[model samples]
Target: MGQQSDGDAAVGSSTEFQIRQSFQNKEEVVLSVKDYSIRQGIEYRVLESDHLKYHRKCKEFDKGCSWLIRISLHARKGTWEVRRYNGPHTCLATSISSDHRQLDYYVICARIYSLVRADAAVTIKVLQEATEANYGFRPSYKKVWMEKQKAIAQIYENWEESYAELPRWMLGVQSTMAGTVTVLKTSPIHLGDQVDESTVYFHRLFWTFLPCIEAFRHCKPLVSIDDTHLYGKYGGTLLLAIVQDGNSNILPIAFALVERENAESWSFFLSNL
Candidate 1:
């Protein structure tokens, strides 16, 4: 009988690699977990669920129990799979109010920021409500907006500081070698032949070291050119010139940054080349 019980336990236990050929509904998964809890002499509750996944926690969640599990629909097999599991509740109380496992705004902010950076048009109001439903408290619209700005700054750094450092950084680039060049043009607004406070700006920066240019003399006659957009507070474009050597190694000959990618900008970049 003891050996039979051990066999039953082994059969019921879940492994990460388990796969099922038959599909099961939410009720079936919950029943299986309920049976498991009964056998173990404990209780659990469904924390969250969607069409594709379910997350569960110990009934003692509000009392600080850390036991939890996550299950999801298997993509290939059309069956339920145990994606995660944590065992052995440690709370002293079996019932309490206010979940300890609930996520705070700081943690929510980090995730919210990531989502917004990936898709700036994501609806924060919808996210706020979703967060409230999932974690039991809603974050205010102002808080979510602040976190979005913080996340953007974290990803791109301080935009004002970046602009201020441009001149000094440009000097450092030109100090490296002769024949290198960097230019800044500010298009100031004019009112009836008088300059105004408003302005539009353009930066025509270019750089090529002596070694790179000299090395290109021995390279093949063919060249490759390309351009890419710069993701910054003030968006712009970058243009590049590259050549190949006898060993087929890529040798970058020149690079430039322009206010926009247009015929005039390309002409200016190529003229400096």
Candidate 2:
């Protein structure tokens, strides 16, 4: 699809010209994918996704879940992202091509990232060529989303050994324009639950701190300053932080683990995370 001079009426025009009916609901997409997976007997998992992410603003919303197709077909860019939103629930796919030129580029890259399964291994060379052919557009920016994904997997495979099974490593993928963005957050069900120190460390590194940094990755890291007290256990409130990386998916490069969470422990973590 090419760019329309004005974006506001693009959807209406597309429907009038090409689409015969309203876009499918997110639930429908999920059901379709799920049904297909079931029929194929593909071992898979649903990813958290947002109803708002997969489809255009339909003036309404529905529930759904994103999926990782256990079997990946050979695809070029825009192979998946341009498709309907499918989900585990609340997993938001990034919109590519707000402008027509970039649309092809984003559509393919985003789709590629979305399909990555932790259990599968792929080569970077193959992924790169596929993106180029699929999108049919040479990206204006130098982008390598798969490389980022590989880096994240390495971090997880390496660090996860330390944590027997406290926090679970879900999935990591790159987003449009932004490359691969890792999604790792806490699923703590109880207050006094035992967790892995490395998981805790990585949790802070990938999910917590990077938001503000990523917002400004195009710019230099924008640093802010503040002060607080140490109250509980540390004579006062000790400085606690959550870190995430925006420039890349929320995966850690390396870490040093411990038995439990503590001030002295976290203090050392703050230095690296």
Candidate 3:
């Protein structure tokens, strides 16, 4: 109703009306630089490739320098920069992911820009030329570092104070041996201090010969049993033994001291056996 119809004048009016009714138009979509940058980050400008800065690939070489640069740059991941990596510059689609085997690179590397511009100090470290070469941030980087800190805190608590029970005299020794055992291990001491072996055999046995019999039970036999002396309070050596194949090893089973290791002691030993 409002405008002229030049196309309709050329075509029959009826044909023009039919064409207009039947035709459906398609829309065009164009994503501008600003839109991409906003979605990605300020560093997107530095990360994107420019033909002038990057030369074309060469057939002579299996790979190019740009390819190497692209491969080295890793991605950023995790909560902190702990495990994350912001790699150097490069060409090609060599971006990184949590798993490096998977090279899932973004067409427009928005994430790379987001991480690079985050801290200004990085700008000075990664010059403009290098920043553009490597694109895309690596993921899963930040999560691994936090776990190690937790382990060290649990394993190294106070070590010196835990062993305080040892007495100053012993220094490092933990247990005590009394009576004759103490005399053998240390030196002479006071009267009431404790008479080691003397108390057991002297006071307990009333100074009888019974204690010698007790010592014989623990003694290992010399096997080269000897009886050079015939008399003394106690004498004669016995064999030492251990059970083997249901028979005793030719070692001592016990000791039999005598008034003198004489025929009398041998008689007593045979009688006991």
Candidate 4:
């Protein structure tokens, strides 16, 4: 096994490589190479890639550029090491577009994950500006929007996992807060043409905290309900019930997530409210 570096260099920022420099895994090596290629505005062709090794050469290697690199996993050391590397590109830059083929959504996700974590409502235009400032290229609006969604999934749990944990979360909330109300509705799971009676999937959830329910007693008798669409992996509607106090202050008393806004959904939310 080859010797490993004491510390792995940060991806997307480390543009230089040396023989025997190690990475945590194959993914890290590939990300670092892609970042370097994008930064230098040079294109590279992948010669080989697998679980054990990754090899790439400059796109113009045959024309004149001698740039190339080979990274292989050092099983004994539990690290991926660069086994061969030729210096910076000697050929002219081939790409002069506003976007780069190597700068995909995954790469953009890594760069914007911190921003997303700090502010979940961060806009795609802001992300695009950030990317352009850092990489000198403006990715398409669709690409940035897709990457922002990916970043949100990373910051908060993914949609599937969030849905899977709903029942547990509801139970915990009820147990920890006395007088809290939670109603979960599930539908039978379907497996292609057959219905799986043994398994069920989440359909809707209605919840209200003890404080909000108690506060509603002192508020006006009138109640207003509204809903907004959820634009995640699974489409849904978020229903909310609010009441106004004597001072005209509005307070939310109930909330629910349903499939859509319709008579049945509204009836369910109102009946529960």
Query: TM-scores of the models, in the given order?
Result: 0.44, 0.24, 0.14, 0.85
Please tell me which predicted candidate would have the highest TM-score against the true structure. Answer: 4
The local distance difference test score of model 1 is: 0.63
lDDT, candidates in the order shown: 0.63, 0.34, 0.25, 0.85
Residue range 126-164, candidate 4, lDDT tens digits: 999998887888899999898777766655677888899
What ranking of all candidate models by TM-score puts the best one first?
Answer: 4, 1, 2, 3
* Candidate 2 segments whose C-alpha is farther than 4 A from its true place: 1-19, 25-100, 104-106, 118-124, 140-142, 146-273
Judged by lDDT, which candidate is best? 4
Please tell me which model should have the higher lDDT, number 1 or number 4. 4
Model 1, 1-273: lDDT tens per residue? 111111111223222223332325554465455434433445667778898887888787777787787878887777777777766556543323332222333434544654665676567787676555544546667766666556556654567766657778778877766655565555666679798766644456766677778888999999888999986568789999999999999988988888889998888778877
**Model 2 C-alpha lDDT per residue in residues 147-247, reported as the tens digit of each score:** 33433343344234533343333232233224433333333333366654443333332322344435444443433222244221112222333233555
Select the stronger candidate by lDDT from 1 and 3: 1
